[model samples]
Target chain A: MGDVVLASLLLPLAGAVAAAVAPARRTVAVVTAAGQTVLAVVLAVTVLRDGPVATAPGGWEPPLGIALRVDGVAAAVGLLAAVVVTAVLAHACASPASTGPATEPAAGRSAYWPLTLLTLAGLQAVLVAADLFTTYVALELLTLGAVALVALGGRGAYGPALRYLCLAVLGSFAFLVAVALVYARTGTLTLDLAAAALPPGPALTTALGLATVGLLVKSALFPLHAWLPDAHAAAPTAVSPLLSALVVKGSFVVLLRVWTALGGDAALASVLAVLATGAVAWGGVLALRAAALKRVVAYSTVAQVGYLVLLLPLVTPALAGGDGVAVDVARTAWQGVLLVLLAHGLAKAAMFLAAGTLVGVAGSGRVADLGGTAARAPVVVTAYALAGVCLAGLPPSLGFVGKWALLDAALTGGRWWVVAVLLGGGLLTAAATARVLAATLREPGPGDGPPPGTPHGREEAPGATALPTPRAGERWPALALALLAVVTCVGSAWLADLVLVGAPPGVGG
Target chain B: MSTAEVYLVLGGVVTLLGAVRLLTTRDRLAQVIALNVTGTGTVLVLVALAATGGGEPDPVLHALALTGIVITVSVTGLALVLVRRLDREDDGG
Candidate 1:
């Protein structure tokens, strides 16, 4: 189990190296994606059965060397990551649009897979690293890979990519400052030891505040989220899934780590909840108003992030009075948090890929322009609808179960306002998703579909094809993903038990 | 409060100024430079933080600082390339 745990960290790096050296791109892509997915599943099971897995690579102990630990939360996230990555990679490989100019850089045919694998490696490292310094470095690597990926966009990509790079680097510097403060206070970078050494004082509080703010910027929360929509909306079709679903969530994983280590200070969680509420309303409004299909999905990501943030306040409601958190409420809330992370990751990745497919077939990305997708791309439309079910927290979806757990937790604590916030976020998401669904399923006039007679839509790029409907290659991958999403929701009860396997003892047990 | 804190304060001031500049400035070059300045401040703060112990500084801290500098430099290089790309986009189509 420990070896598998270690292998999960090394596998992505190994895959990157393998992809670089291999002559064939398709084989390397499949081998790496499949291998990583298997390893992630093994780790998830290991975390469930064994509680927590810890290993110090090269046998160097503690502050000097690095310790990599996988708790239930990390492993559960790893599982979500594995599923999403493999599915997205499969979609990218199968989808005709993915082979276009934008994804193919000047580097080589093999370059895309390596960069993606390397980014996955960095993200995995960030999740498993037991030291702050290592997490920061890993995060930097993640951003570097992501920046390169984002810049591969068409003509307008450069500006958004540059902005992302600047903000991400600045965010890293803030995180570094916080790490230094922790080190100064504890003389060690190991998270557990440093957390133990944290006292209620100016230095610790300041460090936490700086770190939180920095992560907020990186995670694209609320006012600081200016860079996200343009960058995400403008990226190549295949790349948006990686950007929106995984890369943006990386910082929040670190924030979760920092938040946990800080012992979930109630006052701070309260402030975070306020920001989250605003994000829910703000992101929802923007999504509802956005004209572009991809932009709507991007803005919805911001809104979903708000629900994830709400976990902070929901779990630690008693923190405000210094009475300590109620363990039962905290536990249920923790369950809610884990469920939200899992459901959102899967559903959002599916949404991006489905939206990408819609853009590919429709010849336009505008919400108002997405005419006749149901007839033209039925499989993809179905995928989009299933993903929407998850996003909107509809019944039997993991998303619904997650929110149900959260609302239940809130009700237990009698925090009715939070219950309202969660309900509002769901409604807003449903309304926005309805807009896309309606636009997509709307009847295509004589003007819609690839201009009259072009075969393969060659003459009309991004235009409606006269073939009526795209066949299996593009359609199957999305259907598979959507089916998995529906299956996850239906199986959510058992899955919830699995995720709660090694959560903190007092949380959602 | 202490000699090391003096260094910490100075680094914080530098980082704050640079962060404000990075956020406020629309000029690509200025933002890149601001990022570097803020990065430099973080490095200083890390070094100063190590000094506060009144003993030999941790070697890991030095290595970590070097890593930060390397990453910052690479990012700065990448950002500049992107900015140049944007300019070309303007020049042509």
Candidate 2:
């Protein structure tokens, strides 16, 4: 498992470099997809069985050489992420990718291949990183790779790309500052050691605050999420899933590691939970009102993130206290959070990919103009609806099971407010789903007639690169990803059991 | 103040000014320049924090700071590229 983790971390990078220099693009895609998926799958299987796997390059201990650690949580995510990357790459290869934004369509196919794999490599590194500096380096690498992907969408891409870059840099800088501060004060760069030595001091508090703020910005939580929609909305079809699903998850995984490593901070957890609740409500409302379908899905990404962060408060009582019941509840809530994370990643990736298909068919992103997609692309509509089922926490879906576990935890822990927020969030998400479905289902509005050739053209918002017609090769990947979302629903029981084993060591131990 | 303290103070001031400039300015090039200044200050702060009463810098900390420097350079390079593209687009070239 240790060796597998190492391979998973290194292979994408090696593949990226090879892809860049290689004359043949298809070979790179095939080899990378096979190698990355195999390694991640093998590692995930081992992790579920063996608990956790770790490796230190050259056998040097932490505070010295870097160590790569992958726990069950990372392995689960890596497994899903590996599949998503493979599917997207396959889609990219079938359609010429690096039509390098609108400006440099001549930039050649190699342009997209390298960055795509590089993003995966960066994500893998962040997942396995055991030390703060290692995570910092990997995070920056991931940020760069993601921004490149966005910019690759061409001409109009620069505006959103620049905003994304600035915000991303700012967030990563905050994270870096927190990292340096932690190392300086504690003289340790490893999570467990630093958290252990961290005294009750202003410096520790400041570092925690800075790290959270940075991650929140990176995660695109509500108000700090201004850069997300346009940047995500504007990216090329294949790029959206990677951005919405995994790039954002990179920082979020970091946040989880930092908070849990510190055991917990109730005050910060409470404040963040409040913000999470706000995101759930605010993002849902915005999604319902969004003019473009892609932007709606983007806002939903922000909304789904709300569910992810609620784990902080849901489990904080146990992590921050000595109460046995709280610990019991924390265990359940932790499992629920991991499930939600997995479900959202799959659902969002599927939704984005499917929505990209519809946008292509309609030739415009306008929700109202998206009419007739149900009749045109039922497979795509099915995919979107299935993913939406997860988002809305409908019964028998992974989202429902996750929300159920969370609700149970909140109820048992007597965190009634969390319960209210959870129920309210589910309803709001349902509303957003209803809005998209109704718009897509109903006849075109009175003001606008049926669109003609390339229904997506003419209405193109300034700076929005026209959504290309659906590529025949990309449909399978889109449908496969969405089906996987459905499979996760059926397999929720199995997944919950597997994930619960990975919950952090008993709080207050 | 001691030499180290003076360096720390200077670094702090530069970093603060750079952050303010980065936030307040709308010009892409100006933001990139501001980020570079902030980046340098960040390196300075890392170096300053590495010092102990032992009167010597930890080589390991210096290595980490050096890594920071390299990463910052790449980020700045990317930003400059984007800025250049923005300029070209604005010029309608």
Write down the lDDT of every candidate, Cα atoms only. Answer: 0.79, 0.79
lDDT of 2 by residue, A217-289 (tens): 8889877888899899888777888999899988988898898777667789878888988898888888888
Which residue segments of model 1 deviate by more than 4 Å? Answer: A99-105, A108-110, A317-325, A450-468, A505-509
Model 2 stretches with alpha carbons more than 4 Å out = A97-103, A444-472, A500-502, A507-509, B1-6, B52-54
* A153-217: candidate 1 lDDT, tens digit per residue: 65677899899998988888888888878887887888767877888688778888889888888
lDDT of 2: 0.79
Name the weakest run of 10 consecutive residues (lDDT summed) in model 1 chain A: A451-460
Error of model 1, residue A331, in angstroms? 1.1
lDDT of 1 at A44: 75
Cα deviation at A151, candidate 2, in Å, is: 0.4
